[model samples]
Target: MHAEPACETSLSTPPSARWPVVPLQPAVREAAPRQPATRCSTCSLRAVCMPADLTSTELQQLDTVVLTTRNVHRGETLFRAHDAFQSLYAVRTGSFKTVVMHRDGREQVTGFQIPGEPLGLDGVCSGTHSCDAIALEDSTVCIMPFGQLETFCRESRRMQRHLYQLMSGEIVRESSLVMLLGTMTAEQRLAAFLLDLAARFQARGYSGAQFNLKMSREEIGCFLGMKLETVSRMFSRFQREGLVEPNGKQIRIVDLEGLARV
Candidate 1:
């Protein structure tokens, strides 16, 4: 699920002031030429992506339909707000965050994406994207053209069902995030956030109790609706209380139940 700000809010600014800053890096290099779709069936994320319910012959057909693979550098914008929606992307590596730039010029983080996650669903409703998808680190993605997907779904009952599931999950995730922002205390929110990340990692067959925090502390605070200092203080408190062992970006859950109690 992605977390969006309650409103046009910035941790450091007056309510009316806009958040200032953008990735200052130069444009990313162009992506490599398109590769064969055979890569899709063999992708580790096959279960989470296109090949989930496809037979060998179906997978072969899929290879012809996936548009291309793309490489994105850290700080690069994959697609900007209002960009025409053409495809949905599955993260093949690294991570990304979707952001919505406010009319006042502030930016609100909408969601963080990891491997196996599909992005660009927001465009389904409006035809144009509602936010910018930016890479949090060097990443690669498999592009599935939405038009092709729709046609395929019409022909494959399993694929159609899976597409419905993805859409339904996205809606549920957004609702839960809204609740998290409205009713939870800061500590409770942070605790739940960590638990959710752990659960997601475990689902992907990674260690659930320990992992690296790919996003920066400030970014975490921004997403959590807290100041950077507040995020730091909470992490320190968690460590002192023996709930977690955080060393820089590395975090190990020492007491998962204790954290849940927070």
Candidate 2:
């Protein structure tokens, strides 16, 4: 059964730090416009809404508007590093990888974006983005104006809580990545990555143990701090051990328990 939207949280995120609502602005209508045909590049009701829930009137307004759709080709920037953090993006269709370059010009991939996932959210202060978000395939995104959304969030107690909840999870994910890349062996890292992806997909309503990998072995290696050759070898090693049946992009965790053991 689909879950009822969680009650919005009331948090102490200081509204003074960001955009505050003003009287000069036109009063937001009770019924607003919504984009027709919520496409993959367009967010549906679940993923984007997590940072907050919409009132019935707001939903009606949203459902009436037409959202802009833009295609970002593979390896192209959706937004560059240090760009003005003006918008929050939702992966409507396709996938994205966020990367940051080191002082020495090495690229470190920060995270991957899947459908229904929100991005560019961690940027708020200083109005500058810290990383480059790139499309892995031809991708589409829902560009939500950050200032307006934050203004709405300030008024809605629930929305504020949701935003923090989302941010907190991102922090946890990044911290865990640090531990994984810092110490785990190649085999262990690969297994952990798969398991992590499985659980995440499951939460989003897909079969947890079975899914196609949108990232190539090389990209996975980049994220994991391993070489492309090391990633390939680990995959072969896992397959030989009967822990997974990887057929091209298709990967089935034949022995999830076994993989986790590594």
Candidate 3:
């Protein structure tokens, strides 16, 4: 047979030598949402919530202990009655209302909390929460683990004294509420409430003369121990008397002294 026409067989060429190898890039991934870390050293409410005299070292320690923060949506309960207490929460934003439910299903509003206030003190005594702490608006809180806080308190005499002061303040608040309910008239009670709010807001560097009311009239009545109708009437009367200007939830204290006199 005539020499098989020299067939060029390229099968002997290695595949790797024939083609350029390209490295594959890692598959792209979507980033997850980030959780905000608590930084007490730079917090605006540090002056209000934390002690003024804390050294930089103490503040850094606080930041480590208050590493976690929680968001509580409007009308959601932060802690229900009888829940095991592990942390004390400091209000970082918005407000809360503490409520207690009776066997008959009646809800009693105990107190309202604004920014820079502390919660879960009641749990300290019994190791469980005594009432439901519901958010009045979308809110955030710095969670201080109680065990860590206790250890810190033991180390820092200033922090320990501050904790004792906070407890004493709670007792005073309860006593004041009892006095308001027992001795004051409805109008006086309302006046005292407004003035108290003014002072608190003022302390927080807000406009004390005018502010929005987060609590509803019905909730206000529940707290003030008055009927809803009575609370509405009182608000109307205050408006007519030019003591306060109430346009829905917005309140402008037209005559601070006059309201105080009531």
Candidate 4:
């Protein structure tokens, strides 16, 4: 799932310049609607994205400081390949995918972004995007400018550690994907993918180990480096074996551990 990432500008501006000095124009100063952040403090998924030691005031500041965008339609390009990286994007809802294309006009799905996942960190150090980021469905992402993000991280050592952990998590996922593509059989690859996705959904505070698949089997085949028929057959066989229940776009993991070992 590749998303065209949001463009990020260089953070060369002086510290004082982080917040624009443009006076609030009368038109731009309308009473902004009150939209409070969901009570993440009580959510099970908070383990993945909780701000360490952040106060209620800090939470409000983070929300206010960010330029959150919404209503991005499915199949939309979030950012094109090689776009400049100036901000960190955190997905608030829906799904996204990142891809790398080949000289042969083929595409390889690199990573899938779920809610709370950041997709553009691959180029954070270099200040340029290396892949395309596209939304899989209507989505929302909060854009945090790099300079402010840096300052925030510097001020909060825990946040800096969390950022490193996020990057490290990305590295681990990529390494696993590499191994899955390099040595696993198509059937095994398919099993691993299903299991991984099931685990992901469960991590998102969902029940029945069930959710919808935004990607087609053909896209799954492309990422798995197998034929479309192979992907279909694997799914069919898994369903027949009571490993998964597939009803069009909706899916349920009936025998969770059984499917994991498939």
Candidate 4 lDDT over 1-262, as tens digits, reads 1211112211233312522323322121122232344444443344666556776665554554454444456897666555666666777788888876544545767678888778778668656666678888988665667778777778667667777888898878767876676667777888888788877776767663788988887777766767677788888998999888899988888887897676
The sequence of per-residue lDDT tens digits that candidate 1 reaches over residues 82-197 is: 67777888888899998877667666776889888999898798677767899999988888899998998887888888889889989888777767766777788789999999
CA lDDT scores, all candidates in order: 0.78, 0.67, 0.80, 0.67
Residue 224 alpha-carbon offset, candidate 4, angstroms: 1.7
Q: Total clashes, candidate 2?
A: 14
| Tens-digit per-residue lDDT, 1-262, candidate 3 | 1111011111123323422223333222232232565699999998998899999888888888888788888998888776777789899889999976655556768799999999999889867777789999998888888999999999888789889988999999877876776677778888999999999999999999999899998888778777787788889999999999998898999999999999
| Ranking of candidates on lDDT, top first | 3, 1, 2, 4
Least lDDT summed over 10 consecutive residues: which range in candidate 4? 1-10
Candidate achieving higher lDDT, 2 or 4: 2
**Candidate 1 segments exceeding 4 Å error:** 1-38
Q: In model 3, what lDDT does residue 221 have? A: 79
* Regions of model 4 farther than 4 Å from truth: 1-47, 56-61
Question: RMSDs, each prediction?
Answer: 5.6, 11.2, 26.2, 10.1
Q: Give the TM-score comparing model 2 with the true structure, all chains together.
A: 0.77
True-structure Cα RMSD, model 2: 11.2
Give me the overall lDDT of model 2. Answer: 0.67
